[model samples]
Target: MFTRKLGKTKIEVSEIGFGAWAIGGDAWGPVDDGQSLRAMEAAVELGVNFIDTADVYGDGRSEQLVAKLIEGRRNELVVSTKGGLMGHHRDPNGEPVYGRPAKVIEAFENSLKRLGTDYIDVYFCHLWWDKQEETEAFIEAFKQLKRDGKVRAVGVSTENFDYIKHFNREGGLDAVQLDYSVLNRSVESEVLPYLEQHGIGAVVRGPLRMGILTGKFHEGTTFGEGDIRRNWPKETWFADSLAKVETLKGLVNEERTLSQAALRFVLNHPAISVAIPGAKTAEQAAQNVSASARPLLSDEDLSIIARVK
Candidate 1:
């Protein structure tokens, strides 16, 4: 697998990292724990060194599973987890009541326990906080974690550049996770440029656009119970995204699958440090990591994809 330097952190990570969301077995659909463990094992054997999870994902089930994956080889991988969704720190609208330093620290401590690790490689604030005070509280809280040798890097998982600026007002941000894919180019306009300019790592979350860019779903496709995509109304972007995938399918050939092409497209941008595509099984995990082994998209193919609308 091709390795890239995660911006600012200087940690070399595989260009294709494993996103552990689906293995959490809640939002995506039913999953088998044995299969999940094997998927991660397959990824690691393929040289995947980075794994990103969240406290909210299956309410820490993902982190616990990750703990099992990293056993006896914690130093061989880079683990990232997010907080900011726990405790009684939310308003009536369910928006997080940010600026609570104590609660933030508590959340991090709990995550450490769940992962069965003394320190985390990367820690991200799962949600965006608009207020300056709230951002300052997080900065301070994260600073404490770093000082205590708990977290190596701190980031915020948000697309809002404004919120990023507030959090980085003191210049303490290391990375940011945002959704980016062939079907969604929203981050290219400003967010990506800012990260590149400031040397912040950009870890893409949804490089396959929730499997739509994988060309596995068709107009007649339907998701089963507990699948998050089941609620997507086909009358809207769901239908539109499927049409765009047809155009993208032309890039698929004996050299690569549609999913590999989509991942390559995301990695084409210089600002991206790594792309985390979630996999539920060993086959899926191997396929994701194998994208890095294929040749990059040719200029002609990129030109054709650029005009895809």
Candidate 2:
């Protein structure tokens, strides 16, 4: 596993970190809980020390499972989870809720209890709330946790490239997570340059394009009912995204798996410190970890990818 210093924070993590959201099976697809646990165990066995999760994932079920998964071996792993979008799927609709000052602290404590750890290696603001006051509240809340020695670093996960640039330029965060994938290169136009200049490292999520880039689904297969892909109408993002993947596949033949190519492509970005891709099975986990072992593509292949409409 290759490790890099994440900006100026002096923290090191494997280039291929295990993204833990798949264990939730809420936003993604149907996942067997046992297989997911095995995947987590496989990541550790394979020498991946960093794990990323969110409080809303499966509504905290994910965190508790992680707690159970890494119980005594906490020191060997870097557990990073996100907070700030509260309320409840537990309440009524699948609406965006929030955490008050006290609730925010309580949420972090509860997440620790669930992960069975004393401190979180990294914590992020999941998405963004409407109010700056909420951000301030979170700043205050996490500041307390940091002062109390509960969190090692702070990051923000957002799709807003401008905001990522703004955050890094302002200089309070240790890291930032964003959607940076073969399909999502907008981050490179601005966000990545700013991060590099400001000395902030990026955690690239959705590198698989939510599995569309994995060479799994063909034109015929349809997503399950609960699958978030269902929410993205087939006529819109799915069709366009699938078409793009096919174009990319032509550039990468049987010489390499598109999955491998996609993984290598994202990590090759100079600004990326780590790429977190979710795996539902142990085999998939191993494949993801081994992707970094593959040699990078030539400049022409990347340009070919860039020209695909």
| TM-score to true structure, per model | 0.95, 0.91
Clashes of 2: 1
lDDT by residue (tens digit), candidate 2, 36-111: 8999899878878888998888988788778877788888787889987653323254323443556567778888
User: Candidate 2 — what's its lDDT?
Assistant: 0.79
Which prediction has the highest TM-score against the true structure?
A: 1
User: What lDDT does model 1 reach?
Assistant: 0.88
Root-mean-square deviation per candidate: 2.2, 3.0
Q: Mark the regions of model 2 whose C-alpha exceeds 4 Å error after superposition.
A: 87-100, 165-170, 231-233, 251-255
Q: Quantify all predictions' global Cα lDDT against the true fold.
A: 0.88, 0.79
For candidate 2, the C-alpha RMSD (Å) to the true structure equals 3.0
Give each model's clash number.
0, 1
